[model samples]
Target: MSVSTLVPAAWWARLGQARRRTFLGYLFLSPWLVGLLAFTLFPILAVFGLGFMEYGIFGRPTWVGLENYRDILTNDRLFLTTLGNTLYFVALSVPLSTVIGFLLAVALNTRLIGQTLFRTAFYVPSIVPQVAAVLLFVWLFHPQIGLINFALDLLGLEGPNWLGRPQWAKPAIVIMGLWGVGGGMIIYLAGLQSIPQHLYEAAEIDGATEMRRFLMITIPLMTPTLFYNLIIGIIGSFQVFVTAYVATQGGPLNSTLFYVLYLYRYGFEEFRLGYASALAWILFLLVLALTVVVFRSSSSWVYYESGGER
Candidate 1:
């Protein structure tokens, strides 16, 4: 046999040894892989397949080509409205939340008395179960009887009928989103911790003002976490449903009609599975494209400690 044949055998032997050493790695990860395949990948493919059909739960799906997409694109009024509403929410909430989270992280990362407690307090809302949080916000935003209005009264400011008025309902959701930005805050906190103390010391030695230090050192180093939160927060905000559904029921004349809320209405309420599937696919495509753009742009700004000497 040629020497190449012996080389192949040697490589195969190495591969076998590696696999033997890491045998339990696959077994340990089997449950997650199975879940990804069965629940995630399978359902994604199924939804894509369904998007091209008119599917009744009990009947065979009738192939409809691009009819569902055309319907939404050409004639669906609520589709466009909900899409705009979602985009508006993302535009307003994502940046504000990201900035607020980063600022809070910067503040919380400092060495101060009861700092851990402050961090926990900020993070508390994030761990609240979704349904419970939504329901709690329902009472908190009640037009006249809510704590929000109560606080407004204390401040001599009128709290608009939050859930009652369409114009105000979306703003209410945005405010609610800010309250639960703890997830982003925690991520920023982690990123802040990862930032080398020497950078701040260097900035201090250079007589950089606090604001200048933050603008120059803190933000640049925190770009990765900021990018991560921006991407995730935007995606989550785009498909916002729980707040609209629980708080407004997509009411106040569909002012709070979110894209995912509308999708859920079609899928569950109207049983337009195919159309909902199409919406899902469209949302997936939009998020995917946006994430790609963000990642591509990140290289221009994301700092990497300049080879550990930043």
Candidate 2:
């Protein structure tokens, strides 16, 4: 074959291969692109647009300028309360869940009889339907005839009415929040598996006890996973609406009025789309700012297996 003929054939083959690879990549990405436009990107832009107008269901939107933002910042009393409540939930629940999940992961990571069974049991609560789980918790934490109260009574202690007091509302939510530590535990477990076994053996050979080995070797190495769970827990807790909506209805004198729950109330009940849109943007900014701070601080602590660049 002539050199020109050979070169043309090779070039055509390479071009066809490249086209096939590109087609497959787009095929895999199309669903995500569609979802972004339909569910996330479009809605977010629509909300942003809504924030600048006076939107009522029955009334045409009039350009209201920055009135919604002004009201959220300077006027709304429930806005402040719900924001405070949500912040409080994030502060308490995130740390509580992280610590609990970490401890559980460490404990279960040990080789023991029925280890798989124990892991499965711990994880089952995580997959339970939200409504069913909350209902179960309601029954379990009932002031009377509840398993919690019953157990306390058996221990010769009086369990305070968990759902009845404003002082106890946040604590109750925090406690219930710990029930799904299974998800964080699973993440930690994967991180634990990634950690080389030689690290523990080396620490032990140096006369380090189990606790010391874990603190020095495991915990430090697990910082990336720890940071991940911490951030997710904080974000999820900040948007806490389901439990408060179902359990308290933002009740006990509005002690459990979460920010997102209040956002829902404004948007759906009051038809204050413009105000809700502003609140959503405020939340997005707050989360973005906090996440930036977390990423900034991660350089001081989070240890990644990728040699810390990640």
Candidate 3:
């Protein structure tokens, strides 16, 4: 008998239902496991290694030790500029999106006519292709005859060149970000619906007004969903690229030069692959740190149905 044949029959036979199920489940998940290893895990490690080198993509990488990181930390004016811009965007966008989304969810939760139509209208912009949405916004924000500017014109007010001016450009991007707030609104709506109706009824019987019920019950219960959207919004805000890439190209005195856009320019445009890799690693670390901090803080605010720890 072959050595392979002699080894495993008894072991196979000894496997119980739970082990078999686990094995089968892993078999079903093998494709994703392979992808994670090959595409994500391997590339991440490669980029981390590249962060310590001077690679220009066309030639062999030369060891740079910590120079790239030191430059980024101390000397790279554009890096600091982009980092500040990204932080500003994240700080502005995440809270605004969360509050606006929650309010929309609350408004839609009431029994109203054309509710389905309203929800659909709100959600459609989010599903629009990113390139298409950016292009549309470019036209809509056009200084001369765009719809938004035209509306302003009717009010005897002039619209600033949205993509051209420094002061207005980042805010324009944030306003564009709000157009997709419906995605978070839907999540909030689900959380609102899942809330036990009896709690509200009981509160009403105890003479709780609508405002009091919303404050006392709805806000506390919805904290988990709010926390979720807040983290996602912050992460997504940091990675803001498409609008800056397509609409502004990080222009108007680099007013909209976001972190990712700067990284992309280094990697692709300037061909400073090593510096770009370092930038990418920095971004990953920043996001991971922020996520960890948020997770830690969540114990203070987030609610879980299973317990009352918070």
Ranking by lDDT: 3, 1, 2
Give the winner by TM-score: 3
Task: Tell me the TM-score of each prediction against the true structure.
Answer: 0.88, 0.90, 0.93
TM-score of 2: 0.90
Candidate 1 lDDT over 179-282, as tens digits, reads 88888899989988988899889989999999999899888888877877778887888889888888788889988899999999899988889999999999
**What tens digits encode model 2's per-residue C-alpha lDDT throughout 1-310?**
4433534556546666677578557767999999999999999898888888888878788889899999888888888898888888898888888888888888898887998898898888888887787888888889989999899999999988888889887888877778888988889988888899998888888999988987888989999889988788777787988888899899899999999999999899999888889899889889989989998999889877667666
Q: Clashing pairs in model 1? A: none
Off by more than 4 A, model 1: 1-30, 306-310
Instruction: State each model's CA lDDT, in order.
Output: 0.87, 0.86, 0.92
Runs in model 3 with CA error above 4 Å? 1-22, 308-310
Per-residue C-alpha lDDT of model 3 across residues 189-277, encoded as one tens digit per residue: 99999999999999999999999999999999999889888888888899999999999999999999999999999999999999999
User: Candidate 1 or 2, higher TM-score?
Assistant: 2
Clashing pairs in 3: none
On lDDT, the leading prediction is: 3
Candidate 1: lDDT of 116?
89
lDDT of 1: 0.87
lDDT of 2 at 62: 81
